[model samples]
Target: MHTKASVQSVADTARGIVLATVEIAARPEHVFRALTEPDQVVRWWGSDEAYRMTNWEMDIGVGGHWRSEGRNADGTSFRASGKLRRVDRPTALSMSWMSDWDGGQASVVHYALEGTTRTTRLTLCHEELVDRPDACRAYAEGWRLVLGWLQQYLAPQSTEAFFLLRLNPPRPNFSEDMSSEEVALMKLHFGYWATLLQAGTAIAYGPVADPGGTWGVAIVRAAEMDAAWVLTDQDPVIRSGRGFRYEIFAMPQLMRGE
Candidate 1:
């Protein structure tokens, strides 16, 4: 995971041009789909509390049209439309972008993808902002944030996980064998998961009954693996000094309504 590339490099070249580059651990075809596919665009193009991209519509061909709709943190709406000038699948794309906020000025945006079987190098060039130096600086920062979101969206780790819990002794009738203090601790554990479940962060959690022993499992949603660890660390079973531990497994594609 440490070897995967993500952070972007930005540069101000000519008077009107801002160039940025980022490496993604995905095939060119996969990255290209995220670039052109409407559903994928809405997922990776922005963040929930920042610039949220709620809608995307595009026609995939040279001379076709594209549009995006989103909102800022302040509840203000924004929109951008473009006509595709070039479309090279798995390689490059270019378009003319006209946004409502930019005095309706059309800017040329180009993306060049260089990739091997496992990774891709994506370069973006936004031109025609030479006269709008303020816009040029803003774009440099904006593109940096955009590309960072893309990289995180494409990361291989699952945002949801299963936490398997067990007692150190592994007894079949442990529930019946538990002391009064242990029962209180178990209640705390149940309450903790209940809170998360009501908050929609915890999906489901319960005990697994085996003939020889009983173990517990919890399914949860977390934005990152480290975040998942934070939840598990806070589990009452873990913090109560009861010799309880949880083994976590990532569920990259979780089935809903199961």
Candidate 2:
């Protein structure tokens, strides 16, 4: 966990046209969901007084349109529109950014994600603003603040279970237990599941450090319900692994990170 002093240091660096990359403890899909979904976007997209989204419309495809309007606490409104230049699922996004306010500069923003065991590296770049340096700098600082909101907003509050699996290649005479190569294949699967957290399918996941393997948890708001079942169903570990068992026993709210 990052300390308050570290957060203050980050705020201190908000000067001039700076570029920053943030490593978030979330999956690519989860981040993507936050970016493309209106309800999720409302949770973490603006600065000051928690701007309410008045209108949001997006057609997520090449040459599609993305538009939104935000109402500030004092009833001031800001609007923006752009063309979707590119959309790569769970990986990359490119869009032209324009606003209805004065002194606004036209720019293009790009988002790229790379995954780690329990985190995702988000690379965001705003370019083509050589003529409007202030806008660029302001945006740089704005992004820094916005990312903090994204990280805290998405932090899950439930415990998750991870099941590791090994896949054996097709062989007519092979036994149920896997071979040495099959064990290595399981490692690859674990790595892949770790990557899935970047896409937000992970509530919270990491590896078991003693043996250098991946094991992480996802938080579900409720237990013994459909939401939890749906989460386990999409998890690669539980879906593909036919051997492990899933049991739901309740934990107290205080202990569950509530």
The lDDT leader among the candidates is 1
Mark the 10 consecutive residues where model 1 has the least summed lDDT.
161-170
lDDT of the candidates, in the order given: 0.76, 0.57
The residue-by-residue lDDT of candidate 2 on 7-93, one tens digit each, is 111121232233557766566766776677665577467656656666777888989999989887788899988989999977888
Ten residues in sequence with the least summed lDDT for candidate 2: 3-12
TM-scores, all models, native as reference: 0.61, 0.56
Q: Clashing pairs in model 1?
A: 16-130
lDDT of 2: 0.57
